[model samples]
Structure formats: C-alpha cells, structure tokens
Target: SLRINKGMHVDGNWPALGAAAAVAHSLGLTPAQTAQAVQIAACQLPMSLYLPVRSGDTSRNTYLGHSAQLGQSAALAVASGITSPGNAVREYAHVVLSKEPEPFDDTHGFHLLQAYVKPYAAVRHVHYGAWAACMLRPALDPDKIEHVILDVYEEAVIYCGNRAPQTPLQAQFSLSFGLAAMLGWGRLDPWVYREPQFQDAMLRALEAKVQVQVDASWTQQQMRGARLRIECSDGSRYEQEITAVPGDAQMPFTERELVDKFLGYCEASMPLDSARLWARQLLVAPTNTHPFPFWNLPQEKTPC
Candidate 1:
C-alpha cells in the first residue's frame, strides 16, 4: 500500500492517511479496497480537517486516534465482504476539499505526510502559549504575577476565543485555561482536564491573566506555528516564536520513548511484567501464529 505521508512532511493530516493505509495493508486488502478504506476513514474521522479548522478543542488531540480506529474498522468491513461505494475519495473531495459539489482529485502524487504533531497535549494553536508559560515561570515569581498579555496569531484568538470555561473539558480548548493550566501545573496531562484542577482558584487566577490577539501575517499554512509575547507584573517582557511544535516527525520520539509510553499506559491495568512480556512477544511474533497468545492473557478493566 502506498503511504503518501509516511516520511518527512510537515502536514498534520499525514498521520491519519498513513494510519488508514497501514491498516488496509495489514488486513491484506487490494489497492482499490485500501484506497476506499482510507477515504472512508477520512470521512468518518474528520478531526484532522475539522479540529484544526475550529478553535482549540480537546477533540483535536484525539483526531488521529479516531482516524486510526476508523481505518481499522473500514479495513475489517472490506475483509468481511462489505461493499463500499468505491468512490470514497471522490465523494470526500466533493464534500470536503472542493467548495464545489463534485470531487476532483485525480492526481496520484498528492500526499498527506505534510502534517505535524503537537509536543504538548493542548490545542495545536496554543503550543507557544504553553512554551511562553514555561519561559515566564522562571522569570516571574508566581505569587507576584499580576497579568499576562498574550500576542499570538489572529487565528489563535479566533480558534481559542472561549475565555471562561466551566469544565476542564472546556478548559482544554480555551487558550486562557490552557496557559493557566501550564503555568500552575507546570505540565499538561490528561489529569489537567480533570475536576479539582479545573476548579482550582490559583489556576483560575492565572487564567484571568492571559490575553490573546491575532497577527494578520499568520496564515492557515502555518498551522502548528505560534508567537507568544508575554507581559508580566514586574514589568518584564518575554517573547518567543515556535515554527513547529515538538514531537513532529522531524523531532521524532525514540523507540524507547514509545515503548515507555505504551508501558505507562498499559501497566496499571495489567501486571507490568505480563504486559511487557506480551508486548515484547507481539513485537516479534511470527505471521504463522493463528491465535495470538497476547489476546488470551487475563483481561482486566482499565480506567478510562
């Protein structure tokens, strides 16, 4: 199967495309079947296209995850002899890409790998906000920070305009809340979007300090890029511009890092040793194995 953006392209859309192609190939589908699967996956999981277009949202972080799952499902459907309209991509182009009512991309060389990944979990537009928070942390005494003035791309303001969020989930999509979370917690994690922290007085105070603005020069082409200008209580100012968020393929995660993340996520639900062993075996398991032993391991419920 051809993976358009399997290698070095800055576009964030590549992950979904690559994932769909990978799933189709793994399921032993034909080229046409795989392409159809990819189109279906893209349509079913429009987060890549929609998430970025919208202001910062928590769902944006999981867009690729949705694509991956949908791709797997689409491939399975094809393997099960389910018929699709065969014009998945054409339909997508008509409904999604083109303003017109018809799909028109016949070009084979077009690839999606041009996409990038956010190093932090917050919205792609606010990576620099997080970075600015970190940079300002050392310069200003947290107790004395009176206010923060954030000057970012106009699109940033447009995307993350929700200033006051009543819930952590909402806060995850709010620029002010994200900057506040980063400042108070020093990191952005799944828990940062949980209850008490979302309601924390200190975090709320920090959130109150953050202000956003837009820059006319910042264009849609610069999706993951941001510029942060911070004004502090002590009359100190700090400014930084991030061209690309970390964890992009250019700044790829190491294999060990990937393994550690996988272990961290799965170890709590299963015995750590068992999980590790199962993972290791699965990594090297031969194709001839009809029933994978990993699936037969004791199943346990994990916290969602």
Candidate 2:
C-alpha cells in the first residue's frame, strides 16, 4: 500500500473509520448506507503530502481534523440516537471536500520510502543510523576527527535534512538529528526524542557537523539505507552502510520477536502480566467469532 505521510492509521484516519463503524453498528444502517458512510470518510480524507515537520504549524491541523474527525462526525450524524440521516452525508461531503487541495511535491516520494520501511521506519532508521555512528564514535578523538560524511539515498537526504527540529515529530523525521543523536550520545531511543536529551546543546552542535550527501547509485537501485563515513584529521576513515532497514517486509521480524516487541511496548504502561494478556487479546481478536459489537462488524470498513 502506498501509505503517504504518517499513514491512514498513524495520522488517525483509520481510527475515524473505526469510529464511524462503531456508530454504524449502533444505528443499524443498511449495508449500502454503511458503505456510503465509509466511502464518504475515505474520499473526504485530505491526503497529507508536504507537511512541515514543526508540530506547531497550522498545516498539521489537517492531519488531526480531516479524516478521523470527519468520519466520527459522519457516523454520529446518521446514528439512531443522533440527528437524522437525511442530507447528513451530503452536508458532511460538502464540508469535507471543500478545503483547498494539498499539492503534489518532492516530499511525496519520501512518504513512499518511509512506508517501504514499514511499522516504524522513522524510529528504526534513527535508532540504527545513530547506532552506526555510535560504533564509530569511540574510534575518534575530537582533536583528530574532521566533520562526518553521511551518504544516504536521495529520499533520506530529502526526508531527513535541512531543518531545525524543535519537537519530537521534527526530530523523528530528521536524518541529521539521528546521526547527531547517535554520535553525541551513542544512542537514539524514544527518550532521545524527549526532554533534556532532545534539547542537548552539544547534540545540536553535532547535528550541524553532519554533512548528508545523496548517493545516486543507491537511489537508482531504490535502496532504503544509509552509510556513515568518518574522516579523521589524521586522514583515517571508518564507514558502514545499512542497506536494509529493519522491519522491512523482505526481512521482517520473526513472530516471536514481534511478540516480544509488543510486550516491550506494553510493559511501559501496564504490568507484565497485564501486558501479556492485552497482547494475547489483541492477537486473537480477529479470529474471534462471537457477535461482539466492535469486532463483529464487517471488515469492509477498514481502509485498504
């Protein structure tokens, strides 16, 4: 799937569809009406193309407001306990599609590259890119090293550079920030995107030291990876190239690894036992045959 921007799910569009589905269940719309409500949400979605990394920008509003919220409103307007379905879809359609359309630009290709990495490409690349720099960090002495040279695919150069990232979202999207985070701190984890770590002055300085260059050969090959080469004042060099981003469909995490990953994410919020139970429930939810309102709904509402 060509999941542009933050993806239909990550940007809250899929949830909007789910919210609409919930309302559809309560109201018992005909299969045709239910289908229409879903189509309205899907068509009304303002595709996120060239979004600024800065979260404070008004452009970010489309991500939060357009698809998910509209879907929710459409479903509620037609539900039994809500307003009449009369003209509701039409009213919502006019409101939804009325916005000025987003433009097609160079950033659209970056979104495709991001989706190629899948699940968590932004996080994974930043994590490993930083790791590659960290591996070279120990070999260098400040007095002996010159600036670091980062060779990445064209998409990486476009997607990750030439920005001042003030928020986690910005940092998450930044390749320079990732390299700096790894070189300066030897790590780029979730916490690196948060508080004091993100704002570390030295890290910011290192970010400026990173020079990203596009490798046309890699771009031609349609590879999603990066190579970091460090040149010392003494003329020595260290280099590593990452050709396959982790979680890529071609080389996916094992089922057990995925479970462990789920447990890891859940452990942050819930007790280990509870996390395991939650993971199990989510894993098995699809196979469940009972007429539970949420799960029993047809899968037709799901975005492609």
In lDDT terms, which candidate is top? 1
Where does candidate 2 stray beyond 4 Å? 1-52, 55-65, 69-128, 134-145, 162-164, 233-235, 263-268, 280-286, 289-304
lDDT of 2 by residue, 1-304 (tens): 1223322223534446555665566567775556556555554454454355544244554665665577766665554334433343344335544433343254535444444323332445454466567668887664455678788777665555545578776777778888777677665556577678778888787777778888899889977677888877788988887776546655666667667766655655679987776666666755654433476556876422
Each candidate structure's TM-score, on Cα atoms with residue i matched to residue i, is 0.63, 0.58
Q: Which candidate has the top score in TM-score?
A: 1
- Model 2 pairs whose backbones collide: none
How accurate locally is residue 123 in candidate 1, as Cα lDDT from 0 to 100? 67
Q: Tens-digit lDDT track for model 1 on 1-304?
A: 2112212112334355567677778767899878766666655535243433333345555656665666677777666666666655555555545433333446776455645545455666667778667766666565666667666676566556667777554555577877877778777756676677768899888888876766556654545455666665678777677665555656665656555655655644788887777666656667654345656677786310
The candidate 2 region of ten consecutive residues with least summed lDDT is: 1-10
> lDDT of all the models against the reference?
0.62, 0.61
